[model samples]
Target: MSTQVPPIHSTAAAPMLELRGVHTHIGAYHILHGVDLTVPRGQLTMLLGRNGAGKTTTLRTIMGLWQASQGRVLLGGEDITRLPTPAIARQSVAYVPENMGIFADLSVKENLLLAARQARHAGQMDEERLQWIFGLFPAVQKFWNHPAGKLSGGQKQMVAVARAIVEPRDLLIIDEPSKGLAPAIIHKMIAAFEQLKAAGVTILLVEQNLAFAKRLGDSVAVMDNGRVVHAGRMADLAADTDLQQSLLGLAL
Candidate 1:
């Protein structure tokens, strides 16, 4: 049998985000067990794992939503594990949770405006960036004054991502942007993500969709039992059906 070690990429490049020996606990039950992963600068890294594998827990820990009982979370070589959520956000990290996190009562414009921390009002927002976001997700522009709850599922997903990138961010972390979307919408999302990557936005995504992961991921990490069981280039994993089946429990 051939030995398989977690593959590392772009060693010359410093990681925009790193987790070292991270552990998380919720009440008496332990969730994460010493997870170590790295997300390279200007690259899209995908986090994959089956249900109950602590994928979401890892992201929550990074966001400071759930305090890590142990370990270090680093961004640009700075330790941010202990920082508060607002402090983490101030560092230019945008997290879009699986639930989409949109205010049902707010207008689409209001949602994007709220995400621009420096802008107190719609007019104060950076017009160029807003235009770019509109170009990326046109639903946001088409439904500017419409209540968010009135939009369709795919439109709401677009709005959620639009809100995240309403301003320049050092890192964009999203959980399952393709979840519950039609094939056409997922294709559009893949294109949007490609554009974001081309523009040099670092992305960390937790996705159950293998096609989505294979399409946008520059680097990939697969978690199992609350630990990273495999890490490598997305292309490497995509080309190896056997490895995919072993790590993800099914071939892509």
Candidate 2:
């Protein structure tokens, strides 16, 4: 039987975020099954899989949304497996979930302020950081005074992503970025992520859009049945039609 040995960077620089055989349960039912994944320093790694493959759950596990039932979650090589959600947020990790989680009544500035307040440890995020965020997604600047509730779907999505890393994070976990958006809007969002990556943000992206994933991913992990089934360089997978068809059930 041929098995793909997922290439894990065994270096000492320390991964920005990592999950070692993580297991999680929601309510009375267990979900994640021994998931192992890692995000190297300054790398844009993608967790790609179809629905129900535990992609979002994996992101939740890292963000301390669900405390791992087993295994370890490390932020900069320190064990954070038992940390609370708020505590995890303070660990230089930012999470933008599938739902976006925007405060409908809050204005764009208010949303950014909330994230800044929560992340403003040791004067971590200053005016400069906030400006940087606004610059990355200029649309946010235009809607600064506008209430998020009145924003369109694409605008809200931009705000959700902006709020998550407004304070600057060592690691960013983004879930299903391209879901339910016009192709044009998705293109704009893609550029925003590219800017983040170019600025050296280590990202763990959980996305279903294969074409989008190929654009930003330095490496890819295709998950299924709650475990990673295939992992390789994005370029390698992009060229292998058979691998793409067999694992992701996608053409090209």
Candidate 3:
């Protein structure tokens, strides 16, 4: 009913985040069958799967939003499986879900300021960190006074990304960024991710868009029926037509 993933990410070097023998269950459904994944420090790793393949659930389990029924989730050498979502986030993990969290009624600056406030020791929106997000999206600077609900879809996405990174998290988990956007807008999102990667942020992304995934992923894991069947360097996945056709149903 499920396939075992090959040992792809070597342990010669310790990873920034490692999920070993992870098993998760929801109600009567069991997901993440013994999932093993390693996200190396400072590299972008992606999780790919068709709908219902447990990609989004896997991200949720890692975030401890949905506690794993079984497994060890380690982040930068700390065991985080039992930690709460807020604790995990404070430990330097950020998430940008498919529904990019934007306060529709809030101004662009207000939304960003709220996100940055998470890292603030005792305040909301650290001024220095707020400036960094503003710098990253000059458009944000242009729309500081504008309501988020009025911004374009791409601009909303920009707000989402800016919010995730404002606190300078050690790991960023982004889910399905290309779901309903125009190709041009997806490219813009990709470019922003590239900039984040260049800034030395570690990212673990769950993506359905093959073209977009290949472009930013240093490594990839393909999930099928709640199991990881393929894991390897992004370049290997990109060049292997047979693997793609047989396992992923999509070829580069």
Candidate 4:
């Protein structure tokens, strides 16, 4: 059976992740400009924006891949703005980039084994949890010994996600899980996220697909010009076409 964490019921609960006036610069180019964002505990928050809007930069800053030049990144109410990527990961935050980082040379099983820090081998990994993940993405178990590089795009995305959850994670950050996926595969991806939400894992996603976002998002933040321009309930955003057009330039 899945282990259930207490669900977050109110805005009063401490946010699982918070970015306060965060600014980031890469060399001479200033990317993020005083972004203020709050990801409520135990909810899935969608980060939406157009190209060059700095959505990826926000996620990268949260992961510490890019250092925030100003303000702070807080996790469970603690400052982590300056922490290195590995140190930040040790705090139980898992990030999957747009590329879906995985060791292509390794078998699917080996890829998951690496993510499970407590497990030196497949046998040492949590069998119950592995079985649960297998149920979520059957391709993981079906091609256990196949090289990750050999799998199709959709299968590889499943493995990438499965690896992130191989060990329990307090926060899961993903960039565009449905990008380039077929409609059928997108539906399966949606189902997997639904299950994750029910399990109370706090998730932050950057997606261009408004339909997918509307279906899975509990809260929504829209970024423009390196700042969060809009924030509100997903249901509210879904209901207001004029607001959607004004913020996102399109209706959901």
Model 2: CA > 4 A from native: 1-12, 118-127
Model 4 off-target regions past 4 Å? 1-12
* RMSD (Cα, Å) of model 4: 6.9
List residue ranges in candidate 1 displaced over 4 A: 1-13
Worst 10 residues of 3 by lDDT: 5-14
Output the number of the lDDT-best candidate.
Answer: 4
**lDDT (CA) for every model shown?**
0.92, 0.83, 0.82, 0.93
Give residue 75's error in model 1 in angstroms. Answer: 0.7
TM-score of each: 0.94, 0.89, 0.87, 0.94
Q: Give the local distance difference test score of model 2.
A: 0.83
Rank candidates by lDDT, best first. Answer: 4, 1, 2, 3
Tens digits of per-residue lDDT for model 4, 17-131: 9988999999999999999999998899999998999999999999999999988888887788889999999999899999999899999999999999999989999999999
Question: What would the per-residue lDDT of candidate 2 be over residues 20-108, giving only the tens digit for each residue?
Answer: 88888898878888988878888889898878998988888887877789888878878888899999888778888898999999888
Residue 152, model 1: Cα distance from true site in angstroms: 1.2
Clashes of each: 0, 0, 1, 0
